[model samples]
Target: MLGQTAQLRYDFPFLVRTDSLSFRNVSLADAILFTLTVTLAWFISSSVCQYFRLRHFDGPLLAKISNLWLFSSVNSGRSYLDFWQVTQKYGTIARVGLNDLVTDDPAFVKHMCNVKTEYRRSSWYDGMRFNPTSNNCLSTRDEIAHSALRSKMAAGYVGRDVDNIEPKIDSNIRDFMRLLGSYADKKTPVDLGRKVQYFTLDVISDLAYGAPFGFVETDTDVYEYIQTTEKNLPMVMVVTVFPWLLTLLNSPVLKGLLPSTKDRLGFGRIMSIAKDVAAERFKLDVNDARDMLASFIRHGLTPTEAESEILLQIAAGSDTTASAIRSTMLQMCSNHDILHKLRREIASADIAGDIISDNEARKLPYLQAVIKEGLRIFPPIAGLMSKEVPPHGDTWNGVFIPGGTRVGYSIWAITRREDIWGADALEFRPERWLNNSPEKVKEMESTLDLIFSYGRWLCLGRTIALIELNKILVEVCS
Candidate 1:
């Protein structure tokens, strides 16, 4: 019995010593070193997994391992050119980030954006939200919800449901011309870009509400809208590169830092204006009204939804059309031959008054070609517009893309492809549209139409923008 008790006592002391060794105190440096080692191991493993997943696709070495490459490119303020350069070097399908692939393939873009496409918008679109608490049509990622919202707002955008769209447009054009005339009289160098912006804003505002914002009449950047947008848009675009940042910004804690309707300048002021206009419009009987707000109301949009969409119209509608105008004008000014051709076409066309009718402008073949060519060279919105792959995965040109990958369009590269638009694609040659065969023209037209997007995601503002373009170019040139 004594021998057995001695053995138990010895074993217990040994076990206690082992336990004491296991719980030894770790120094601060040791703890930090251990944490760093674990982090490094996790990072390396993660990079390896990501690299192998898309190792078949070629991109910058850094891009294959991190999103910092993309963030840096976007911050350079010429991301469109950088993206184009990437595709030019790596062919149609090129990796731009750890999990992001961009393609200049029109067929692939169309397939992903088709009416019944399974691809949903990527989380990148979350950065497009104007209101931190709300998702505008541009930021809505769910296909069903986007479609529903589009349906409610389609009538207002289509112009058939709204009254006096052209007259309102003509009125704004008159105001635009008068403003330019004053500039000409003064013999001062006018900033055509700023004036063009004013014209577009006035036109859209007149169409949306019953009256214009008087940007042309006042001859200034109303509410500092231009300055604010210039400063804020780049930062907003930067946020899109990091999905987690968007989540953090939109979260309840940080949401208070974002723009609100009460702010006295920039987007918030515009939002405040929209809210006030919407409030007044909502009090009227729907049957007695004829503007876009009324059309939205008649088509079953609630006051809050209408307010959001009206703000969208003012922001998106004005800027895109302004870009189209400025680019087309710049192209014409740069090429005397093209400018002469356009002027000749406008001068020869039969028009009823100072402003050319949309129908009249459409009949002018050269003018139409000029518009198309301009849009091709400079697509207004150079955004990535990334779409997420379906859960089951997708294959393009026999390359298997893993599920949950983000595929964005290289819009600049696509528009400048030598194969599609011929060797002179980079040049602003309107003759390409006029010289092609009917089938060729049809193909080119279909491809160019992608500037407004395609299928279920086709832009609702397309018709309105076209009307503005069709009138403004002819009137200005004449």
Candidate 2:
């Protein structure tokens, strides 16, 4: 009798068999309503489960449910400051996104960025790639590949090699000074930020490719590369929080959806330039070594490999050094004492040149202190440095972060914390770095150097960047 009833119900469309085994014809609207009710219940249950899964960590309720809050926060143009505020409101170890946690504690920062860390960089870095398919040291998510690449490229960035590249930097510095002097003579208000950016661009380009883009010589961004870089960064941050959006950003088939021509190019001109330089370097005689490109070729890198590394160097080296230079200049201009003292130190060093060498600049303790202070007060890459927790997960600072979770610390937030840096942490005091005992100086150095980064992934271009920054300051102050 039950089989007969089920078969009869199946024969009729939209027929419902009740618990009492009575068959009834159901309207289309009723069926639709019933399906909707079940779907709504499932969705609610799933959301509740997801919320409970991460209930151990504290965060804004909206953030715990959707990445929309994180995306909105980043798009607000003050993501770093906003995330820092999250800590104040929710305490350290706050969940800033559905699957991301941010902590301001230095120990946790150290653990996340350790040289031989179990934690690997998060996919946020994937948004940094010029090409999604090509892997470079900066954008590679694979631990093994990154290490291998870093080892291969290490020779080019060693102190001695960077020193070897200094003459190229010096030549560009001379042109930069000449341009600035022209502005001074004219008494024209110079955009020092743009000038330093052009200077750094020319220097890094020359070192990377045996030629500059002529930004310093031209006294302008000839290719508007700096503009391109600035435009992409906000988008990069957006993708870091909403990685699902990477497809629209990077996919050629979805090119129409991209917001700008710059996005579509994705460093096209720069990559082409790198490739051309690599090709030229590859054809060089074994005895005719030139620059960083030669070093890459010598280390058995293919033309493509050389281009990738050169692109990384130029992109990483230029903007950051420019930021440091601009920040230092602004701080000095605002604080006359710092400017005068730095000038006095440069004069006393007896540096005999229109452009000071890095070694000579290093001798000026006051100048060094000012540079360190600027780096501390205004880190170039002040955003989050995210690392993914290992598959096994780990506990940090008494909080158990689950496996596959993204965690990071903001250099901007960490450096400005009053608890760590004292009540006057907000002050732009270069003197803080000087007149301290050896122990105090060591601790300060440790804190300041963290800006470059920590452990195995420490910036490869740090030496060259320091050279450019120190030399530029000595020249400007003198």
Candidate 3:
């Protein structure tokens, strides 16, 4: 019994060590399991909170917890159609993201964009920066800064301080007409899409720097600029969806991946051109030239600001105006009646030259109506120009929206709303503008004007765009 007791005591340490080993193995497994369980719980809880925050708003099932729906739609290259469909399905106000809502309500868009409104530009504008380090007029969110910038640029864009703006545009139109005559002589198919883009680019450049970029004269996409823009737009649009991604892309570690002025192609080449032009203007006496760049410098714009704003003008002015021209031309061609009617109006009007003047174009009711209808059917910019809710929160359409929520304009949806534009809203009918009663026509015009935006955010290039449209459409139709 003594020996057995002694042996038992000796083995007790071995038994205890074995038990400790087993306990350690179990604890390690338990720790891993506990960590994974907590992580999953956190994700689930976060999703639930997000889902309930905007539960009152209707949207795709996936949008309640993720931005995947929005991302996928944009990635599909049919965001315009997809977004319009969503609004059509879910009413005027619809949830498009976890914290994002889009509305086709013109009143909502007007309220948000009012000069003195509490709403401010969203972070989405951050992704609009051509240079990650700088802010152009369109990308700046600081209200005071934007207002000041707009003041300096307004004179130039309105052509109030620039000379020969119409003559410069006509010069480009002449180049375009010459090109078309050549194509006609050869009986070759003219790619109006490419040619129109060239015309607009050249006109913008000529107005901007007192010399065209020669896009129309050369009859080519110089430096592959248009091709690059088409390629990068989708990705740039996707980046705007995630503000953090934009911040990171602009960060020191990743900014190297962005386009640089040093590059010899695409936007980089355009930046280099703008910089060179600005440098030359800076070398000359400020009073020596009276173009857009000079106008900007006269208004106290810094050299850097001048360059940035000029690039903005080239980019914003050219593409949007080109789009308007293309859509209008397509509509006219599709309906020979509209085309013949427009041509007759231009023919009967007293014009001194081949190129119709802006004043004359304005007098042609059918032409003006056709332009408006084109813009209405397809707004030049279909992106979600979102505005952030005020910190104090506000009610929209009787719904109390929480602060920090983002409300974007579904401009495509708004422009096509049957409630606003009538039963045939989707049709490309110019008569809607003419046949309506005076008050109704006025309302329709006001709604269509929102394409240029409203109040403090009204497009500075609005006048120039109109002048281009008024002149080019008439010339083409004639």
Q: List model 3 lDDT by residue over 1-478, tens digit each.
A: 6565556546643332332322222456666887899999997897788788889999998987888898888777888888898899998889998888888889888999998899999887877777666889999999999999998888888878888888899988999999998999999999998899999999998887779888888888998899988888887788768867877887899877777889899888888898888888888887756778888898888878878887888888899999999988998889998888888988889888778888888888998999899899888887787889999889976898888788888789988888789999879998988988999998888888889988879999888999999998887878
Candidate No. with top TM-score: 1
Clashing pairs in 2: 115-456
- What clash pairs does model 1 have? none
Rank candidates, TM-score, best first: 1, 3, 2
Model 3 poorest ten-residue lDDT run: 16-25
Among all windows of 10 consecutive residues in model 1, the one with the lowest summed lDDT is: 14-23
The Cα RMSD of model 1 versus the native structure comes to 4.8
Compared with the true structure, model 1 gives a TM-score of 0.91
Which residue runs of candidate 1 sit more than 4 Å off their true CA positions? 1-44, 251-253
> 452 in model 2: Cα distance from truth in Å?
1.7
Better of 1 and 2 by TM-score: 1
Q: Candidate 3 at residue 268, lDDT? A: 82
Ranking by lDDT: 1, 3, 2
Candidate 2 Cα errors over 4 Å, as ranges: 1-50, 161-163, 255-266
